[model samples]
Target: MSFPHVTIEGYPRVGANRELKKALEAYWAGKIDEAAFTSTAHSLRIDTYRRLRDLGLTEDYAIPADVAYYDQVLETALTVGVLQAGTLDEEFTLCRGNADTAPLEMTKWFDTNYHYLVPEVADQAFEPNPERILTIVREAADADVKVRPFLVGPVTLLALAKGENPLARLDELVDAYAAVLAALAADGVEWVQVAEPALVADLVPADAELAALAGTAWTKLLNVDNRPNVLITTPYGSLREGLKALADAQPEALHVSLAPSVLAEDPTYVDRVLEAVHPETTLVAGLIDGHNVWAANLRERAEILDKLQAGHPDVAVSTSVSLLHVPHTVTAESNIPVDVAGWLAFADEKITEAVALANRDEDAFARADRAVRTRAESERTRNAEVAARVAKLPEGQVQREPQFEGRKEAQAELGLPKLPTTTIGSFPQTQEIRKARADHRAGTITDAQYTEAMKNEVAEVVKLQEDLGLDVLVHGEPERNDMVQYFSEQMDGFISTDNGWVQSYGSRCVRPPIVIGDVSRPEAMTVEWAKYAQSLTDKPVKGMLTGPVTILAWSFKRDDVPVSVSADQIALALADEVADLEEAGIDIIQIDEPALRELLPLRKDARPEYLDWSIRSFRLVAVDAEPTTQIHTHLCYSEFGEIIDAVAALDADVTSIEAARSKMELLTDLNEGFHSDIGPGVWDIHSPRVPSVDELTELLTAALKHVPAERLWVNPDCGLKTRGYAETNESLKNLVEARDRVVASL
Candidate 1:
């Protein structure tokens, strides 16, 4: 039992200043050498440990050396020797894919917004690769910053594997893990944090198979010779019946989330967790919320810590989930209002809270109590008009009127072609576009200058789309910063940060807006841009907007109110924008709900409530649109099988999804239950490799079997914002050519 009083499963790997993001992007672009990239990672690793140590976390397993060079799951896959990549270039290809090999499929890690590279174990071998994690540990050791090494647990890695049933490979995988453990032990490591999130990710009342699987995996791991002390962290809790399996093998310590959302469904949750753990095993109470930025209710957390620590043999305190979900520090954000910043706690601040609770610091408790209380009591958190609108929201199932069948004919009146070609809202965000945006925000460029530059870019994009012979087009979104952040900036009751960058997926960072109070649109977001883009071309240009559910999902939402209420408030704001877009003569509007499936409750019992509110919030956005308006919604990168019915229920005239990466696998599920017009993406926008005309044609042809050629829209997997113009131009041309050939053949 060597775990520290305050420890985390992992720290934020993206540097406080986003050093890792810059380094990785530079490496990917070939703008930097391997030595330069390695140096940057070395610095980031040292910086994380030093920063955590300075912020009241003790040395020796207190700071987990979770240096996610790209992604933690990818790191774990390498450690277990499952990913099978040989070189740095090959490893990156496993993440981003090349001309031949498609990148591993990525989905949201559990219910959080962060996406993890799913392990491809269908036809892969398992062996130990200790060099990756060990190298990082040694790097930290050289800096005299002792830290714990972290890994995804054997059971979890197998549980989340794609393409094949990996249960049979458990014994083999455990052997590989054992080798890694032995290597760490020989390297003078004292402890390791193994994340078994699978145990709790989809916890049920009782799952005999899962329990047995976990029981066997833990038994093998703990029994391995020369193993380091194991701290098995079942983060993002709701362990429920899964606790018995974990308790069977008394680990050095166990980490569990006490956040209500995870630990719900039982009044005896705390008691059950305490009871389940062996008397010798330390109990690490994950009482502080790690997913959101709100300051911990130290008073309430102290009460729980007091119960856990009072005479308990070895008790510590920590966060309910990894701090990776949150930004590094609110202190880095000089632009955020002082009053709002006071209520928030980023990764380092959260760790400080954990240390305080562990040490039973009363002064810290008093300070946190005041901050938490002030947020509750503040008038700034509430708005009368926003409250009135939320109250007036229509009751019942809230389905939109004149469903897809009725609107299909009205939409056909516009006479769009078969296999209509379009992008998923944005074109490549060039350096010029980024600079203009930055300059405008920095006050170096006047409003007129920025607007003119954006209009020029939009016109260029429209011309490019026209040249590519796309049936529909986009304004290219040069004026926007992020899909969610752009909308949050113009709305009331949201705090947009200047430097609060958290990793969304590999080197792609987003400053998630903080939803502070009741949300309302001050004027219209994206209306003038839509109107101007439409004015440039007679062809329909999509009036792009991020949907309400997505905006709420992406933001650090208010803890005081239910998240559903926040979604509705945002829906109302976006509804106003949708109306304005429609009034501006932009009929082909698309409100992207890409995070729709991201926020689905992990538990089966809890999903109905989430689906009801989330789907209604989406419908409310487009419910007021005209029949011929053709409101299109795009969802991407998620496992949409779970929400196919809900996706159809959304009742958008058309729904485009991330189908390319999954090779139209969703079409099978969609064909069974879905009724609306569908777009199964033909191009994988995340990768640098462009799909050939034949590849796109093949994908479009496959899609036509499930969805009619007329209903099947051809597009890329997601927005082209992260891509470059050269790749984007070539890809669009191939995509349109693919569509033309398919249409001609039909």
Candidate 2:
């Protein structure tokens, strides 16, 4: 068996229109049995394999053997022996958890917005479970689909874990990987891709140390007896010391990314790559960008492919990363504008494009060139007003006339108590709420009727919060679909989709709005709801808006302009909403920037500029506010130590964070430098379990050791949109009870 010249790192596992999501959720809820769930997952894998073959990737090892019931990391953990679970239900419990147990902690994967379950690396005995991998391989082979297994490499798995140092047992881990590879080889597998993305990341360890470990891991894995050919992949970041280590190991194939997200480099980069790559090894050039949906310039990429092929004896065409980040296909979409649709390529299109590039199909290249040229020349692509407004923006826009102390003094008039309780905005979106939204969308209900239903939901939320004794209230966001999509749908310069759903985590998918032009807010997005909710409550209600950087990070980025400029334009649009909120008498505004830390450039040298623009974009939202208005912001689901200064620089009156699941671990990073009033979440809302009053009190009490009682607020780790009403109600009751206990003790 030989390595395929055209290959993809992975395909979208969740089916088009989220068939897998529905099936998984149904299985979790016990609506579908294990057999049914397995059947759905089996069908998805078969469909993906057939899709690759249909697109001319018929060669052995061309299709990726990556399918996960929940997450790739969780699946890798199971396959490589780090996690030992007995059954399918038990495995799902490891990620989603039972009502009695808390699941694994999850965080952003690399610089991407997708989340992965964090592996817990305690003193558990390591034993390989190759059944899951072998079964999938066997099934695909039985279906006559030759595939390559793509997996999380040992070094990366160890580096990404949360407990005791797993790298100390690298030999044991890599040996376990060897056994799995041997099993696959026995099952007729020809190639396996071991993803070591951490090698290119900015880890706590020095590059030299990680590279040494990487070299050791690869040397053993590649040399394993009776095993498939090893393909070592380092996605997202540009190659540094990681490349040298892999090149020295002389892997069967070395995959390098040319994604636009990687830092632009010198024209001599191809020469350097040729010099570093092993002479006899296959070099898989990831010429297609997988992180975005925009079309690739085939003419330009073809020339680079020519140069690379001239240098290496064996060169394959592939995407820079997995198509899991994108939707299933553009063919399923019908709502996109004609020119924009012509200039777009989803996961399926990307696979065909890879094969076309590998075969040097000139007609495909010409069609791509024409579409690219048309997009470049389109009148709708640029807006003079947007450019001029951003250009003429005043200097020191992020600087506030009033610091936190002055703003805190002004906010004192609201008489919020120490450890004032609040949610992170959004209550449980009940079935009725969902139905109302769906009916409104389907035009079954009049606009006025829908408004009445939403107002009723808001009123119920306010009264419910007051009864629960929460000091601050939120509108529960029943009218909105997604935090980012709600704003994007109302604003200019973005396109909404009917079937574009990319998996954010397990069964949690987000349709990222496509940014096609200059951004502006033609109208207020949340002011009416905020105003109406405030009218129903004497306590201050938060006027919630997703922050500018988060809005940009969550959406497909606009490559035509720098991200900083796009973020600024979005900030200005949100600034208008902020002003409207103030005019409508909703003083406490929470602008959520949960994706801020996730979007930091992987290279340390490139971070300051990103932080400068991202922080400035966030600060720009509340810069024009009066001193009496309290501006709060939130950041979550990431390690924030690298950007703690930027978090402080947000100049928010209060800052809430996702700290509950990690048990206030983020406080260790804050120390005395973070001066904003802090809310370390008391409940892990992502999980279904409702915590006891005692548990919330202990977390709040621990947080008090890090910050003063006066500066602390109690809240959930994030919005409760995905949670059920029963759990949300009980959780808030326990949270408020815990806050009262802590306040009385103080």
Candidate 3:
């Protein structure tokens, strides 16, 4: 049952110990020199390869050295000279846009949590950067470890890129890639993994033409003299028509994901792939799950492999995708319950599972079975009261009273300004705020002292908003660590870890709370802060809570329950909090659901059911609010084209979305008869840049074309927790002034 080969597609970018994140941040903040940062990255690269070697994965199989300076896509851009200027500062600007410059467009990395900077291909010439690739190869060589170099395939890079005729320069880009391949061969490398995930996406005729162009590029790359054996890896979903296009490239091997693909649901999908692939090419069966925390059912995986091996006899085994999505290891977690820990597998454990499956180790399969059985018997999987409550829920519990017109009439009683202005819930979490929370956690500050510090911050934020003439105010959220994690800490049935950090974006990591059992709120999580902040201002303060769907989307929930069931429990908990806030005289409540779109199922067929329950969960939280009270929900970094129907079904009084980065392009999708009041963001808050009043006015004017001026609100794309006070103040001031001008014209 043993396969001829075993290889990992790639490893995580965050170092095994997160040394790279700390090093990169320190380097950017001018706390360290370039030499120190390079040394740290080099050491991490060497350590990664050495660890893989020590774990019995040799260079002939998995080399474990495809590391990124920041992100693989960014590194891919650097490889092919996509940047107009190749300076480090320009590189930084591309990844993190500054005050004067907008960064490259960012999007989800093919159904995974990782985000990649899209390559800007306008008027850029291609050149090979073999020195950068060689540096990592040599670092592995210095450790006496031979390695396989990884590259984002030409087809995928061009497919995910922006600009006119991105694939028009395909020939030149292929030449550059061929030179890189020849250089790798000269350095004594034996294999290269070229990732082409675009093959799994739904492509139109124009995109199919680009895909064919990519195939031509790959053909040229493999034709390079002394080129290494190249394996084309396609993850995320099944490749159908695109597979036929890629077959013309004639690679030495092809790797396809099985876990998230159609193959997992239907074994007959193997036959379809076999028909599409080149008969002579080696087929690498991706068997292990890479995106989830659950351990693979080894027995079931073996049966699936049996079907694939019948058609392709020399099948190699691998993880379904890169293990980068999961955390590094579970062995370091001592506080987690033993039974729950036994049921889980992190990236390190997943690697071992892959190797075991390759070797057909019976003991590993036996252990996996026992862990699955143990989890079934654990009390963490069952909650009688929660189940009973869910079963008895009334049919109309998710619908709010009196519709949008009545709610709008009640909202006018507050006498807010036209084109009302507000932020997306949080102000900048400055160093003083962070330090105060840290001091409180360390037991160095009394409860009274911490409360006073938080109140002072709230007062300052209230004054700042009033000075800017903002129509709405927020409590600044200075005491919270993360939107989801902050509430998870206060609720029952969740576990928080001190060191369970995972990278969200550049230099920013989140410690997602683990939901182990039935979730419920013991008391109001944000009421005290909301009341205190409202007491400081005559202006209406928006009481904020992270939406149930977002809390469930971000956290690692118990595997036994359906995600809908867990989300329902969270919705009920948040429903109680919403009622408490309304009773406390907080008329405006914002439930933020930024992660809703990110959690959509990659397969189109699987999306409707997920969207149905996810929308219901959001509705269950805000359905009971009084018509006089304004209910707001925020969704950021989402593509609203397909799910705008489900979004309208939530029926919040107001929904603020992230649109500034796309310059109101998302408004086109929203023109299809949406029910709620809409607020397309006026400017990007993720960047440190302060938007000028003129720029804000231009964006607001664009929004007016789609939304009635009376129904449109003005705000930033998301929270300002990651920004600074100076920029936040300037941005809000400009935002209010732009709204004022727009209102005057109206």
* Candidate 2 residue-wise lDDT at 509: 90
Please identify model 3 stretches exceeding 4 Å from their true place.
Answer: 1-4, 84-90, 97-102, 203-225, 247-249, 260-267, 274-279, 393-398, 557-561, 638-643, 661-663, 687-689, 692-702
lDDT at residue 259 of model 2 (Cα atoms): 70
Ranking of all candidate structures by their TM-score, best first: 2, 1, 3
Error of 1 at 119 (Å): 3.0
Q: Write the per-residue lDDT of candidate 2 for residues 613-694, one digit (tens) a residue.
A: 9989998888899888989998887767667888988989999998987789888889566889999888988778899999
- Supply candidate 1's per-residue lDDT for 131: 91
Tell me the tens digit of each residue's lDDT in model 1 across 1-746: 36787877677787988899899999988999999998888877887788788898865778887777788888998998887668889889988888787788776788777888988776677867999889978888888877889998887887777755776788888889999999999999988889988877663323567778888888878987798999888887568656888877878888888875555444577878777888788888888889888998888877777667664678888888999989988888888778778899998889888888878888998889889888988888999999998899878567665777788877887678887888898888889999999999899999999999999999999999999899888999888778888888899999887788888888988788899998898898888988988998889888998998888888889888888889888888888888899899987989899988888776677888889989888988888888888989999867788778888888788889988877899899965457777888888887678889999888888887788766788889899999998899899999888888998999
Tell me each candidate's RMSD, in Å, in order: 2.8, 2.3, 3.1
lDDT of 1 at 307: 69
TM-scores, one per candidate: 0.93, 0.95, 0.92
Error of 2 at 130 (Å): 3.2
Task: Report lDDT per candidate.
Answer: 0.84, 0.87, 0.80
Candidate 1 runs further than 4 Å off: 27-36, 83-90, 97-103, 122-125, 131-145, 203-207, 264-267, 310-312, 467-469, 671-673, 687-698, 722-746
Segments in model 2 whose C-alpha atoms lie over 4 Å from true places: 99-101, 263-269, 395-397, 415-418, 639-642, 687-698, 724-746
